[model samples]
Target chain A: MEHTWDFAAILANWRVLWVGLQGTLIVFAATVTLGLGGGLLVGVCRYAKTPLLRLPSMAFVEVFRNTPVLVQIIWFYYAFPILTGIEVNPFLAAVLGISLNTMAFSAEIYRAGIQSIEPGQWEAGRALGMAYQQTLRRIILPVAIKRILPALTNRGIEVFKMSTLASVVAYVETLNQAKLIADLNFNPIESYTAVALIFFAVLYPAVQGTYILERMLRKSE
Target chain B: MEWNFWAVMTDFDLLLLGLVNTLKVTALALLFGVPLGLCLAVLRLSGARLVSAAAAFIIEFFRTTPPLVQLFWFFFALPILIDVRMTPFIASIVTFSIQSSAFFAEIFRGGIQSIDQGQWEGGKAIGMTYAQSMRRIVLPQAVKRMIPAFMERSIELLKTTTLVSTVAYTDLMFQANDLAQKTFRPLEVYTVVALMYFALIFALSQLSIAVEHRLAKSGDSTVR
Candidate 1:
């Protein structure tokens, strides 16, 4: 049996798809902002060598990084409310889930970045009478961030792709919106194809931009 | 509600069933993915530019796209497009094998590239056919170098089996999600599932490290 392709239905639903695009952007923005902020703190805590902070940070990274993100999302949507007695909006829950998950990964990336610096850099800063905090902020961190940006950017892209899973929790992101349209219109192919194209449009450029940035940074070095 | 240790223990059968299915998918994915990946890798490295480019595009497409979307496409979209129905198990296996081959291709490519140019020339000097040299000389060394990467991808593929849950596959994650919804105890159920995944990946990683150390020691003797 041959099913006729319908372009008109998709065209009519353009507004819905556009709204879905907005949702995707919002979630992506929120996840990047919060994930990076939380990741930075977690990374720093892991590096600090304080027993209280280091142990917990280590555990958090290991657990989150190892498990699947889909399971974590389900946990947040279903379990977090029971644990905390506070309801989370689907968008917030998705943002928090993706952010926390990416944080675990970013923390390790940051730790590796900081550790990859030559020990002599730290020693020279100390010999120059710079305080530990000053040495790190002024010398170590700048070098480390520059060196790790490629790895970090790659992780950021992974998180961006992963944001599609937010649909499972009913977040109305691009994929979720497409799924809804498909269910309503009974055209899963068109709906999902459009969604895939939109995702590729957004992600392809970001990937190219990262590569360009990496090259420019490398040239400067 | 109080913790029902006995009730949870009795449900061990359910968990065990889920674990069995999970292992089945993981093993099937590896069995299909590794050999296909190797073939794709060889195809990409073939002297023919069109073949290499085609292989590269397929790899890039699969690698960059989300596996969940790919799974959905295989499970839902492809049948609509082609008018052929696939069982969920078949769809899961096909999608996973395709997805994993992209990763394996890159790993194998890296392994092949790491071999010295002298080895290829040495094989030619000995009047061995290219295919025979690859089989007898090049591949054994490449396989050694490829082990750590192969192990890493296996761990990733194992975790990715959770995406099967999206297609309503009754894997471990699906069981956890169902149990969480039923018991209204998401944390406990998911935590258990996560711990199971962690244990398996950790053990695999440790095994990879042991193999890597052995490979490094052997390489040192050969270099000397």
Candidate 2:
């Protein structure tokens, strides 16, 4: 028996790869939007030290942050349907699981960013007869956003990378699609290597761009 | 679909196997990855431009890429390329060590760079080699300061070991998924697994906090 590299087999499945790329991107974008918004609410609640709100949000963050998303995806894929009697496709389930998983980490990031603002800013806002809401809206948010923009961007890149985990639930993301094609043609090296490179290409620039943005922001300060 | 606590308990052996595998992988990865990553950090700080550039490239490339995909590539492709048949466990170790090493390399570099320049010059005044100075002066302080960050990375690595199940290595996630599929009691089975993970990681984070408090009490802020 003779074996050789067979990239052409994978190349023939370009449309699947393209669709997989779109799937990955769609999940990434959805997680980013939902996770960041949820994280902001959780972060604010926890940071403001509201006992009832803070305790549950903190618990949510701790649980989600600790567990692997692979289990979360599986649980949501199977358990959610059983619990709710609502069947979701792999894509939707992966998105929900990953969003919740990422939301916890993002909430922590948001908390740090929120706390980076000095307490004096809050005092001054109160001195101006503004509500806590107004102070957060006008002052804390702006500074925190400036400080944590790069961090949030970094997390966005991570969420994109994490989308690969969706492959486990039989989601037709790039890695799973590549695996199907690879197994078909017995071109694991070429197929998987190309998949890795595809991820690298999508993710590398985003990470480096964040670095440059952070440095520039630091300089301007 | 029914929640059966006893069913999950009966299958706890499988879950425990997965848990053991996960811990084994994590401990091995940290044991190897930390030192390898430290070397990578030193390479990145090498006097030669190309050495540092190569180190930086490897670190950034792995850091940005997906570890799960890397695991897939190594598990499926490496045997074909290298003409060696390795177990899924070995493949996971290979993939994770490389990936975690990249992450730890960055952490190590951060720890190293935070050491004051005057300390390095002081080492020069004592006519100590870079290696000796690092052994005696820089590393002791840096490693202490890095304890919290190291524990955080360890927790990340532990969470990451769950991915080993994807390669059919029967890690906790895999076993839970397997149990769910076989028993049709996914809600009950997966809930147990998730809680186990929560307990383990929460304990680790608490330990990290305790270590941080001890560091503060000792007044061992390294920069001084």
Candidate 3:
């Protein structure tokens, strides 16, 4: 049996997918900001000498990192409201899950980057009468963040891909919209294929750029 | 807001079965993905331009797309395209096996490329064929160096298997949803299921870390 390929359904439903793209972009922007920004703070806590700061952050990273993000999303949607009497819409739940997971994963990345800096740099900051926080903010993080640019960029890409998971909660992301198109038009093949191609088009260049960025970093180092 | 454990306990057996199914999928996906990845790695490194380009396309396509999308495509779209009956179990396995294989291919490529050019030359000098050298010399060394990365990807694959639930598979996450609806105790059911995943994945993560440390201590240069 030969199956005929038809993209007319997808072409007609461009507006539906456009809305999904907006949703994806919104969630991706929100999560990437919260995830990476919060990650730096948690990463510093994980690196701190104080046990109070270090232990809890370690536990936070491990719990979020070890569990699957889908599970986290579902838990927030269905379980969290029961626990805290707070209503979580699908978007908020998805954002919380992906961002927290990214935080845990990127915290380790940031910590590793911070650890890679030399002790002499810290001493130099201290020699200039800088406090611990000031030295870290001024001396260490600039270099560390530059060193881990490729890694953080990769995390951002992962977050963009993860935005599709929001659809599991019926959040109107690209995959969810594709599902909608497939159902309404009875064109699963075209709908799903179009979604996959859309992601590849957006991400392939970014992935290639990462390869270039990594090579450039290696060269500079 | 009151907590209740007894309600969740009644359906505990179902969740256990779901956990078993989850592990079964993960184990099956790994069983298939590793060798497929090696084949992809070999093909991607082939001297023929078309063959290598085709392999690279496959890898990048799978890696860039979300696994959920791939799962949906396989479960929903593939049957219509291929005119075959598709089960959730089969779709989950096929999608994950292929998806993880793409990632594993990169790992294999890295491990193989990390080996010195001299290793290949040394094998050639000894009158060995390419396949002969690869099977006997390169793969054995490369496989060992690939262990840490292999294990890390496996851990990732396990976590990713959760997507199977979206297809109505009886994985732990699916079972939790079922149990929650049945018992009206979403909090207890989800928390417990999340903990179950945490325990299983955390143990594997620790085991991989241990293996990595041992490999590092034994003076073997491991590739990521």
lDDT of 2 by residue, A52-94 (tens): 8889888899889888887788889888888899988999889
In order of DockQ, best first, we have 3, 2, 1
The DockQ of predicted model 1 stands at 0.52
lDDT of each: 0.82, 0.87, 0.94
Clashing pairs in 1: none
Question: Which candidate, 1 or 2, has the higher DockQ?
Answer: 2
Model 2: CA > 4 A from native: A1-6, B220-224
Stretches of candidate 3 off by over 4 Å are: none
Q: In TM-score terms, which candidate is top?
A: 3
Task: Arrange candidates, best lDDT first.
Answer: 3, 2, 1
Taken in order, the candidates have interface RMSDs of 2.0, 2.2, 0.8
Which of the CAPRI classes, incorrect, acceptable, medium or high, describes model 1? medium
**Two-way TM-score contest, 1 vs 2, winner:** 2
**Which structure among the candidates has the greatest DockQ?**
3
Model 3: per-residue Cα lDDT at residue B56 = 99
TM-score of each: 0.91, 0.96, 0.99
User: Once model 1 is optimally superposed onto the true structure by TM-score, how far is the C-alpha of residue A63 displaced, in angstroms?
Assistant: 1.4
- Model 1 over residues B37-148: C-alpha lDDT tens digits? 9899999999999999999878877777777778877887789888777778888999999999989999989888888888999999999988987888888888888887
Q: Write the per-residue lDDT of candidate 2 for residues B119-163, one digit (tens) a residue.
A: 999998999999999889998888888887888889989988889
